[model samples]
Structures are given as C-alpha cells and as structure tokens.
Target: MLLNLYGIYGNFPLGKNDMIDNATQFGAAVASARKALGLTQRELALAINSGERFIVDLEAGKPTAQLGKALAAAKVVGLRLTATGTPQA
Candidate 1:
C-alpha cells in the first residue's frame, strides 16, 4: 500500500526539478525504500547508527527529526535527493 504511493518497487524517478515538498513525502520515500530492501525500522536504525525511536519518528513524518541523521538514514537505504539547478559538490 505505502509502496504503491511511490512505486511498485519503491523507486521514484524524479525529474530534474522535482521536489519532495515536505517531511511527510520524504519520510514516505524513506519508509518505502527501507521496506523494499527487507529492513525493519530497528534494523535500519542500527545500520544508520541512530536510535530505533528516531527511525520510528522519521518514518512517521516527524518534522523535527534532525536533518543530518535523517539524511544519513536515507543514504543507508539508498534514497537520494536532488536540488534543481544546484551545482554538484
């Protein structure tokens, strides 16, 4: 159900200027990808060196979740974001 919100395999192909728009959208992507990769929230937290609670909050779309850790979790699950028109670093 959640995966379908993004894609069958939870892979979203964004256009050059596409944006996630909000924390909930970003969280959904993260959750979908994590599941698609056969990971539980606690497992993902361990993999990202974060607390299980943090993963729960993140997947629940908690807007106050720390950005750096959130990005790290996303990275561990192979989710990426793009800022349109920004130069790659």
Candidate 2:
C-alpha cells in the first residue's frame, strides 16, 4: 500500500517498498527530501560539510559513498534511517 507523507514539501507518496533497501533508494529519498526543502544539492552538501561532488555521487546513488558522510547528509536532509522487525535467521 502507498502512504502519503505531508510535510513542508506538501504531499509525497511513501510506499512500503519505498524503504531504502539500497544506494539507489537512499539517493532518491535524499533527493526528494532535499527538493521538498527547496535546497540545491550543493546547498545540502555544504550544510552537511561535504563536497559538491560527493552530493552528486550521493544523489546518483553511488554505493561507495563514505558511511559517515552519507549519514551526515541524511541527517541534514531530514532523512532518518530506521530498521523494523527482527533479523532473519
């Protein structure tokens, strides 16, 4: 099912499968949140103390991005990472 998230960016879809399962999803979510906040990629990078190229790579969903930097960027963009349910055996 699809959920609608209403925030400063208005309303956006939030589906169950929309979870950030990989770099591509992470990038898309970051980009969506950033745009919703009316921020440019460079602006977000600066806010997170990262480089513009890093932001570009991040938005492009590059899996090799530094974990620290990626987490920082997510925080700046108001993206929170959370895990639900128990681990599979």
Candidate 3:
C-alpha cells in the first residue's frame, strides 16, 4: 500500500480536510491528486476542456489561473473542496 504525504492510502483518495493557504499550495495538491489518479497533464486539460498549458501553468501555481477552470480541473481529479468561513452579513 502506498502512503502519500497527505495520508492517502493505496487507493489514493487524495487529501481530506487539507487546508490550502495559497494558490501555490492548492496547485500542488491538484498536481498530487492528478498524479495519484494516473492522469497526465494533457489528459486532465482535455477532460476539463482546457489547453495543456493551462494545466501546466495551474500545476506550476500560477496565481492568475482562472478559478472556474482550476476548480473544474480539481474536480475532474477527484479533489473535493469545502469552503469554510464566517459568513459576513
């Protein structure tokens, strides 16, 4: 059984409740999840209707990466996201 840095097991379910403090960290997590799923950057990009460069830039932690596309990539790789914060009224 392979154990990843995020405590993922053989099935490579990816991170759980991982805190992403910045775009770079989120990109890293997305890359990890993509690799765990045995998906190439191009494959992930195609799946999300994006160009390979998008995946490359995203995985490289480009802060300007579009949120919608990035989120789509993350979702395709099974990276579940849960936003938590105090709601501003």
Candidate 4:
C-alpha cells in the first residue's frame, strides 16, 4: 500500500535542532511505514538482525553513526533512499 503522508506535519518540535529533527523525522517515517504494514518493532528489528532500540532510534529519527546500519535498517523496514534533483511529483 502506498501511503502519502507528511512525517513532519507540524513545527519541528520545540527545539531548533534540524540535524536531530532530521533524524527524528527519518525514524518517524520508518515507524509509520512499519505501522502501515502492521509490523511490530521487534519483528522488524529481528528481520534485520538488529536490536529493538536500534529500530526505536531509527524510528525516532536518530542520524545513524554508520550509514551501513542505517541503510540496512531502512531496507529491513521496506524503506528506500532515492536522490533526485528534480521536484517530486
């Protein structure tokens, strides 16, 4: 199912930390996608051979220290990263 929703609907929290906010937003996105697919955090974490906290952090939008882990988690949660200079449709 294709779900179109803004992960960041309101103001970016109270703090003005864009980097942290970015990570949090990213995590929220993963969390949302997982919920949309009806997958528990543990289930998703196990599927990706990771810890629940890791998923929690990711869903919380924590900028991963390592890109590989982030990518792996994203893949496990059916998330993909695409780069496009053009405006999205």
Q: Which candidate is the best by lDDT?
A: 3
- TM-score (C-alpha) between model 4 and the true structure: 0.62
Against the unseen true structure, what C-alpha lDDT does each candidate score? 0.74, 0.72, 0.78, 0.59
lDDT of 3 by residue, 47-71 (tens): 9999999999999899999999998
All candidates' TM-scores? Answer: 0.74, 0.76, 0.80, 0.62
Best by TM-score: 3
Worst 10-residue lDDT window for candidate 2 reads 1-10
| Clashes (candidate 3) | 0
A best-first ranking of the candidates according to their TM-score comes to 3, 2, 1, 4
Q: Cα miss at 40, model 3 (Å)? A: 0.5
Find the 10 residues in a row with the least total lDDT in model 4.
11-20
In model 3, the runs with Cα more than 4 Å from the true position are 1-10, 87-89
For candidate 1, write residues 1-89 as lDDT tens digits: 11122233435452323357677877877887888788999999999888999999998899999999998888887776655444446
- How many backbone clashes does every candidate have? 0, 0, 0, 6
Ranking by lDDT: 3, 1, 2, 4
Q: Which stretches of candidate 1 lie over 4 Å from their true place?
A: 1-18, 85-89
* Deviation (Å) of 5 in candidate 2: 12
Comparing 2 and 4 by TM-score, which wins? 2
Candidate 4 CA-lDDT value:
0.59
